[model samples]
Target: MACSACGSDSAIVCSLSDEYRDYAPADAAVISICTHCLTVDPADATSVDTGREVEPDFSRLSDSVPTRPERAIPLVLAIDLCSSIATNRSAIESLLEEVERAGTDPLLVIDRLRADPDVEPAVDLERRRHQLEQLLY
Candidate 1:
């Protein structure tokens, strides 16, 4: 089956893989994983959030906007997160601004989000951080 996170045609559900690395926990089901993403560390740029099993509880961050992630990589992550969370258009526009902006490393953007208090349970931020790891990185 295709990976819900990266659209890769290599996603597979492993009953033997480490549960600690599972992405989602759909009710009574185990986690699904992709071959490519399962290896990339979330701390790395080319990372896919392999262990996510549920929709992140980002409701608390509905109003906690992240800083504009400029450059290519950061921009991609920001845009992906915005789209995933259905952030307001105005906020998106502001986030796209390149004022004093610079590089595109995914970690930079992840770090920015890490600093934000809205992203509860550090794993939530990691989930979004590598949301596009397959496509971009």
Candidate 2:
């Protein structure tokens, strides 16, 4: 179908991926995004064909939105956290002591990594964070 706003034939309608379902409104069952103008329109669950699963053009979507490297945020956060630990031993020791009470969980580790002040927010980073949050449950 042609996009309503941009009149682009590159309009793609697809069911939201499970990984990204949380980003969509709870009521949105299917969504259509125009590749040319980058307009997103969500539709009722009944609108999509259940048998044919079409993947949205993620590269196009990523191009239009600001994004961080998907897997690198955590690694970068970890490296930065370690750097902080190396440079500020006293502060690190205090924080470690505080967190020691909570026990060590991988999800908690990710939460700490995500909360780092240096990790700037971006569309891709939020998407990855949500995906990870869902997986942990």
Candidate 3:
């Protein structure tokens, strides 16, 4: 395939090794990218037979595996709380009720300077509701 960005023909068909190893049949098509301009070259690519079989390596399983260390990962969940409240209060109430039932602590972060201090909690709740609405509809 020609370089999508520069339209260069001097491209090499490279195998997506990582993708192939993680998820894909051995006989799946090999995706390639241009080496010169680093653009995806689909035309020059070809299917490769990986020749993988159900052969398990039992040598490495003799010893017990070590426990993995806890790591922090970013997680973002968008909910249409605002839209639910505006369009259907029952749905919003149901979601909140479920959250309460699950005993999950919901953390809400907001720009304090831009919000009124007296009604900061209310504002935050409203803002979150609006964000949820945007995500849903």
In order, candidate lDDTs are 0.35, 0.41, 0.30
- Ranking 1 against 2 by TM-score, winner: 2
User: 25-60 in candidate 2: lDDT tens per residue?
Assistant: 342556665555444456566657787754444444
Worst 10 residues of 3 by lDDT: 69-78
lDDT of 3 by residue, 13-128 (tens): 32443422222123223433333322332332233334642222211211111111010000001122232345545444444333334443222221221233322121234456
Whole-structure CA lDDT of model 1:
0.35
Which of candidates 2 and 3 is the stronger one according to TM-score? 2
- TM-score on alpha carbons, each prediction: 0.25, 0.33, 0.24
Flag regions of model 1 displaced more than 4 Å: 1-102, 118-124
Q: After superposition, how far is residue 92 of candidate 2 from its true place, in Å?
A: 31
The numbered model that scores best in TM-score is 2
In the range 10-84, model 1's lDDT, one tens digit per residue, is 432322123222222332122333333221112221233456633322222322322321243223323433444
Ranking by lDDT: 2, 1, 3
User: Each model's number of backbone clashes?
Assistant: 7, 0, 8
Model 2 steric clash pairs: none
Model 1, poorest ten-residue lDDT window? 37-46
